[model samples]
Target: GYKGDQIRDFFLTYGDQGRDVTVNLASGGSPQWYGDPQTEDWEVTLVETGTGARIKRVAAYLDQPYFLQTYGDGIGNVDIGALYTQHVASGLVSTVTGVHPTSRFGEMHVSGERVTEFNEKPTMADGWVSGGFFAHKREMVDRYLDDDPDLLLEKKPMQTLASDGELGVFTHEGFWMGMDTFRDWTELNGLWDSGDAAWKVWA
Candidate 1:
């Protein structure tokens, strides 16, 4: 509910794009939408829940076998259908998109106190981190998550799922970036402006 008002106003203005929206609030009240919502087929429900409680709260309103989850700060061209296919094929409760992020500083390969190779801020070649894209079975909500206000999906929940052999990873070797800081924001905007944003796979 950090930007509850702004989010509500945005959906109220342009949420009729074939899908319904439900804005969960941490505060305990549902405010009315002004004017007509412009759609008879779509429904919008504004309710009370925070990040920690979002998965459980949202799952309560859903009747599907699979649910998608991701952080709002990251953008990527991850193939959702492929991810879901992998998740189901693995018979896992959760599948997270793993990405190789770029290193922030210059990289140097040294041999006996001598620099053998150097690359400036190269993409990490050895490890993958969560790109924040996720595909999950609805069972994951009840089985791996909880209602505690401090329950983080990336923490105990994911760890427990991994320990239980219910977690899978989809390796995404495409463009992915996280807008966590001002520099990242600027860089992403620059990519868009230059028409070099690899994540723009749709028209």
Candidate 2:
């Protein structure tokens, strides 16, 4: 697992019953998972924190656009590879993809010396890092903010870093998902409520 203090700022969870806790974006949009009703779902691993019960990590199937819109603005923009390229070219980032490349989804092709390309696939590691539920150091946050005032930590910095080859990635050997639209949310939620969600971590 990634280590750092800034990880505290990235996720949110709510509990209604012992087994009815819900997790989603902490600061933006409605607090619901996004994507296809049948496939867009999350598996939450809870751990004890100083604050109380908190999510350790989440295994999620998300809708790309919805995830980007919800968390993307905070980071910068959601184009993982493009954002990183921009940062690297401008000296805004130092390391890209902290973890292995295989941890990422979507089309991320590395071309000639220091050149990379991103495809239209929704969840690729093009301009962003593999940060879902991962932790971060407080120093990283300070470095990120000091560089860009308009920076949305979740969206812009990762892209900026990737552009500069300073972003780090955490490859997870597990299931993942994304939901990009309202319809996707509906479908995923229906499946979750029906107890057939493939991404369910509760039961």
- 128-196: candidate 1 lDDT, tens digit per residue: 999998899889888877788888888899999899988899999988888889989998999999999
lDDT, candidate 1, at 164: 94
- lDDT by candidate, in order shown: 0.83, 0.39
Q: Over the stretch 17-45, how does candidate 2's per-residue lDDT look in tens digits?
A: 22332455566555444443333255533
* Best-fitting candidate, scored by lDDT: 1
* Residue pairs with backbone atoms closer than 3 Å in model 1 (clashes): none
TM-score per prediction, in order, is 0.80, 0.34
What candidate 2 gets wrong by more than 4 Å, as runs, is 1-131, 146-150, 163-165
Please give the RMSD of candidate 2 to the true structure. Answer: 16.4
User: What lDDT would candidate 2 get against the real structure?
Assistant: 0.39
- Model 2: worst 10 consecutive residues (lDDT sum): 65-74
